[model samples]
Target chain A: MTYTEQLNAFYKMVSDECVQGVSLDCVIFGFHDTRLKVLLLRWKGTHEWCLPGGFIYKTESVDVAAERVLRERTGLDQLFLQQFHLFGDAVRYNREDTWQRQKMPMPFESRGWPERTLSIGYYAVVDQTKVMPTADFMTDECRWWEVSDLPSLLYDHRHIVEVALQTLRLQLSWQPIGLNLMPEKFTIPELQRLYEAVLGRSLDARNFHKKIMGLHILTRLDERRTGKAHKSPYLYQFDRENYKKALISGNLSFV
Target chain B: MTYTEQLNAFYKMVSDECVQGVSLDCVIFGFHDTRLKVLLLRWKGTHEWCLPGGFIYKTESVDVAAERVLRERTGLDQLFLQQFHLFGDAVRYNREDTWQRQKMPMPFESRGWPERTLSIGYYAVVDQTKVMPTADFMTDECRWWEVSDLPSLLYDHRHIVEVALQTLRLQLSWQPIGLNLMPEKFTIPELQRLYEAVLGRSLDARNFHKKIMGLHILTRLDERRTGKAHKSPYLYQFDRENYKKALISGNLSFV
Candidate 1:
């Protein structure tokens, strides 16, 4: 469908039910094969791509809108989503310029598009294996893009992604990771690789092991993975009680 | 002036120039006399208090709006302000109920006030001694209240302040503090007191001193504070270069 046609389909709800001048964009982060990936969607009838975002209904909270947006795209509800930042520059998106670039008609303020829309940016960590990517009405393609290599995103989306990643990286100091990205039973090296991908740098194996162990938020299982050429590493899972405690206390001392 | 009269004077500018359904609330935290204080304002002709907040102008970014709001209330510009959260529940402020409770006439949607508004919450660390509080057109009084003992705040402001302070406390894990809250020359014990005030708990003086020294973010001047009966303690100021580096790197290892 053309951009106008697609927008016309939901224009009423968008104008009346949703709050004007306020929307939400989510940076959905997924980890797989030791590579950090972000979910992006290709705009329908266009080559441009952007983060999976949606508008907030007058009845829904910003967080609820974020979760609804994420669920609509990922086919998963109740992921570990967090509101990281708000992108509210007056020139974040020039409507005329953006429409010209997209080769779409400019509906202007008459179509409920505010001159300056403030976006609440939320970041979520999910296991890539579980997400069944689905496209929304405005997008034709929904897939993961490697964080290190991304398409030239539309408007201020590139900056938004950078801020989201930076927020996630800094959050590692206070919040425990690998809970959503890792398997229930995984080895230390696998966990370290996840951390390395998220941090965008390698850590000393010894130091990483010591730090993760010191937190005591993980439980070493009696079982071990077999079929490796080398010595089988012991499998471990998050100590749910301790992990929840550390999260609530916000004192997880891992870098 | 009454609430209606106060809002009427700015209604034209607010309706025409400001972004609808979006506002900014500042949790301005100040440390004084071993207490953490928050700057609040009393609504005109009402006993209710709330965080000093303002709406974003159509031409201004949210950060700029926050800075503008902070400057208007504190009479100080360029504070160490940080956006921490967005409070956007539909029930955050029930306009009709709020007006009835405040014993004011409900202007409803006719005024600039929307049924639902999303607030960008920013937390600022400032030296209380440097602030000269000023009331705005909508408020009659502006001053500091010890966080431990606060009046019933309007709308969701009490919750907003809690979230801001929690964010500030968690931020101490990675971000250096006291630069904006402390005097130019302060002793180690004085710095410790500042941290204690923010964290809402006492710290071991020896341990705090050791940790702070290890961070190398402070420069011990060749001077001592000599106003007490006890031995004078050496005065120190933040090492500008190191402090900036720590802030940018977000790797400060103090809590």
Candidate 2:
């Protein structure tokens, strides 16, 4: 069966169950115009925008739940998603009076459960162009917001975001940072913007390029951007196999 | 009303009505007699030993459940316990069965509604001398086993212990180690044994001393061990303020 069928079957099985459970929320990070932005969804009945999230089934593994959430929200599975933290505050159960409640069916509203709900926070960085993320948009709208100045989120979501950010920072130092968040083929500037968004600071362009190119995780491609001016920047794609090997060997560090 | 009453009330109320859900299993690590070991418990009416674990309450945080399990098995609450990994395999649901297949109990040996059971793993290093392990020995028997030659465990518990071991190895590179698992005041060799246990290998003793002593997280306690046959080694304890400052500054990489 297809992924959609599997999801539909899962939803059919547990739509009205009253048992205690879990959901996966993705703080999908992306780079747009040199800024790091996160994907947030508006509710159908409320105006508040929150991170993209999905409920879990009794039969599903927690890792699979995270992958499914990533797939449902972005139409992109096998992306660089991670399970960084689990948020389980008892008060977070009452969604109607909390973060989900604030979402109005306006420009930025939420369409979530009306009962006791608990969730785990899974986050990912995807190449903005690779994701067709108008997913699950009913009366609710979806859009990206800058990381530095995030709109208030529901419940302890802000705290969840903080944990994700901390995990991202630590991971960056150990793993190659930009490849997961960017497209398969991209210019050096695109890679630079992704890092800038994540690090929330500017980096010396020449030095950043020198450091990244030195790692040899990328291979220069033949293609160039179509709708651009100035010298047509050359595109480079991640050397996947070598990068995986380098990752295991600790040759990649975010710093 | 005390915590036990509140917890017992919560447990009894949810036993029939709700999915009391997760259990927290601890894979506590220790360095003893030049070997690495983990704390284990053997359930009553069973011949095998397993990780000491218990259920989480509807209202209490998962971390609290782990702490309660630690206290229940070993009578240690104030030890250094950290959330290492979460095990949520679907195969884990038939866990009680794996524990009692051979004329033990019905589920492990009877019949009941299938309940989903995921577990969170926590590990702590404590002064074993202070712990008064379970006295009744009814539900289970508790003891510490050397990690190098661990007996096959119930369900995915052995996998859970492996995860804890990996987390400990990762923590060794950056976080302050040896202190919590050791006596308040210990010699340089004590710290070395811990590093070796966690890394599962040997290191140059002089280099290990240079690396640790260079960090300066230790306070030279004016004491020495009387029972040792070798030269009287100077004892040391963690400098609380220095440790806190190191944690805040994100300088705690040890692996």
Best by lDDT: 1
lDDT of 1 by residue, B16-71 (tens): 88998787899999988888899999977788888899889888988899999999
Model 1: lDDT of residue B28: 95
Give fnat for candidates 1, 2 and onward, in order.
Answer: 0.74, 0.36
What class would a CAPRI assessor give candidate 2's docking? Answer: acceptable
For model 1 the local lDDT of residue B104 reads 57
Q: Could you tell me how far off, in angstroms, the CA of residue B217 lies in candidate 2 after the best superposition? A: 1.0
Residue-wise C-alpha lDDT for candidate 1, range A1-255, written one tens digit per residue: 766776776776788889987778999999888899999998777888889998999888888899999999999886799998888887897677666655565465767666778888999999888899999877789999999999867778889999999988878856887788776788999889889998999999999889898888889999999997999999999998888888888776556
lDDT (tens digit, per residue) of candidate 2 on A1-255? 744454455455555442246666788888778877788877555666678877666677777877887777778877787777666555554445663376322211122222334467777988887877774633257778887888857666677778888788777777885767776778998888777767767889999889888888889989887776688898999898878877787746666
DockQ of each: 0.76, 0.42
Residue B161 lDDT, candidate 2, scale 0-100: 87
